[model samples]
Target: MSVIQILIINAVLVSIAMVVLWLVSLRLKDASIVDIFWGLGFVLIAWMTMAVATQDLRSILLVAMTTIWGVRLAAYLAWRNHGKGEDSRYAAMRDHRGGSFWWVSLVTVFGLQGAVMWLISLPIQVGSCETVPMSLPNYAGLIVWAIGFLFESVGDFQLARFKSKAENNGKVMDRGLWRYTRHPNYFGNSLIWWGIFWVSASSSTLWLAISPILMTFLLLKVSGVALLEKSLANRSGEYRDYICRTSAFFPWPPARRHGSKLV
Candidate 1:
């Protein structure tokens, strides 16, 4: 299939998926479930491309890496959010929309997400359509992806464990991966897309470069750092200190010892 054709088809698929989810949200009365499906949305697009597009080692690799990243994220979110009521963000949106929340959510939450996920999946769509022999970029991309996968997986694990501890209640997390950065998971997520871009891109496929760029922007500027900090800002003196010392996105060495003040 041609690139444009694949894009058109996947756009429709994504729209339909979101509509279905909207219906499910209505039944469950929780738009937060959409967060759990965010990763799976990309997984659907990747595998759909793999199934219909011409297959090559590179395409297969893209699908494999995407599945590894997507499935784990979705499952982890499901587990973490289990029994939790609607996420504050979505609940706020629902409250803001009043009686129109169903349609409002259809347009704002599910529809907007489907649109962005489709844009991000451009690499998988473009990359999987072309056949090529594996090269250095491919292997290099895999290595980078592995690094990101570990950071995301391990970082999430560390944070979850810290939060589960009774003594850590209301405390700022600054251990393990969090010690290096305030948002190791977001950093790892950015790396994952960039690494996938490396695997999928060539001179001809360079147009797909925006995939990782958009994902990085959304993570750093929009949903990831900006939104998260609003809640974390007033949590404690320890968190403020952690923010002072720890990098926001990229993993870096702490600028000061925990609980230390700057001179």
Candidate 2:
């Protein structure tokens, strides 16, 4: 199939999936379920693109990388968010919108996310249709992907474990990967897409660089680092100190205060 046809089909599929998920959220009265669906949405688009396009090694690799990232992300969010009720962001929106939140969420939350997902999956859609053999750039991209996966997965695990301990409650998470970067998971997430873009880059597909750029921008300035940090900004002085010392979106050694105390 042509790349345009593949994108059109994926767009339709994503819209349908979002609508169904929106309906389910209405039944559950929890728009936060969309968070779990976020990763899976990309997985769905990747696999569907591979199915309709050339099923070569590059496409298979892309699909596999996406699946690994998406499934792990979905599972982690599911586990962490279980019994947590709606996320505060959606709850606040619900309160602000009153009764209209149900339908508002359908358009603003589900539909918007679906559109972003489709746009971000452009690389997968185009790469799957390219019919190219695995090359050095592909292998290098895989390595980059592996590093991102490790950081995201391990950072999440560490945070979850830390949060599970009652003693750590209300404390800044400045340990493990969190020490080097305030948001290892977000950093890793941006890297994942950059790696995917690298794998997908070609003479024709280079235009799709916007996909990863958008993803990184979202992770840094939109939903990931900026949003989360804003919420944590007033939580404690320690978080402010953490921000002063740790890298925001990159891994670096923790900064130290006078007397050799790690900030």
Candidate 3:
């Protein structure tokens, strides 16, 4: 199948899935469920592309990497959000929209996310069509992907452990991977997409670079850092301190404060 055909099919499939999920959310009255499915949506597109496109080593590798990342992310979100009622973001929207939130959420939440998912998964779709032999960039991309996976997984584990402690309540997390960056998970996620794009890089596929760039833009400016920091900005002085010392999106050595040495 042609790349365009694969992308169209993936879009349709994702749209259908999102509509069904929206219906389920209406039944449960929880639009937050969309967050849990966000990762899995990419996995679905990866596998679907692999099934229809060329089944070479590169395609298989893309599918594997996507599956590992997507499944882990979905599982993590499911666990973290378990028993937590609708996320505050969605709850506020629901309250503001009042009785019309059911239909409004279908367009704003599910449709928007589904569209983004399809766009971000462009590399996987296009790369799966590549039957050419893997080159240097492909191997390098794998290494980058491994590093990102480590950061994302370890950072999440550390944060989860910290949050699980009762004494840590209202405390800013400035240790572990969080010490280097205010948002290790978001940084890692951006790297993961960039790695995917690198693996798929080719003269013909160069235009698809937008896939990774969009992901990075979303992480740094849109939903990830910007939105989260806005909420954290008013939380505590410690968070403000953490922000001052730590990099916002990239991993870097923390800046030292008066009377405190960098750890």
- C-alpha RMSD values across all candidates: 1.6, 1.5, 1.7
Q: How accurate is candidate 1 locally (lDDT)?
A: 0.89
lDDT of each: 0.89, 0.91, 0.91
lDDT of 2 by residue, 1-263 (tens): 78779988999999999999999999999999999999999999998988888888889889999999999999999999999999999999999999899899999999999999999988898888776666788789888988999999999999999989999999988899998999999888888998898898777678988998999999988899899989898777889888888899899998879775655
Which window of 10 residues has the lowest lDDT sum in candidate 1?
254-263
Which regions of candidate 3 are displaced past 4 Å? 259-263
lDDT of 1 by residue, 1-263 (tens): 88888888899999999999999999999999889899999999998898889888888889999999999999999999999899999988888889999898999899999999999999899998776666688679888888999989999999999999999998888999998899999989988998898898876787787998999999988999988987788666777777888889988888955455642
Residue 126 lDDT in candidate 3 = 91
Q: TM-score for each prediction? A: 0.96, 0.97, 0.97
Backbone collision count in every prediction? 0, 0, 0
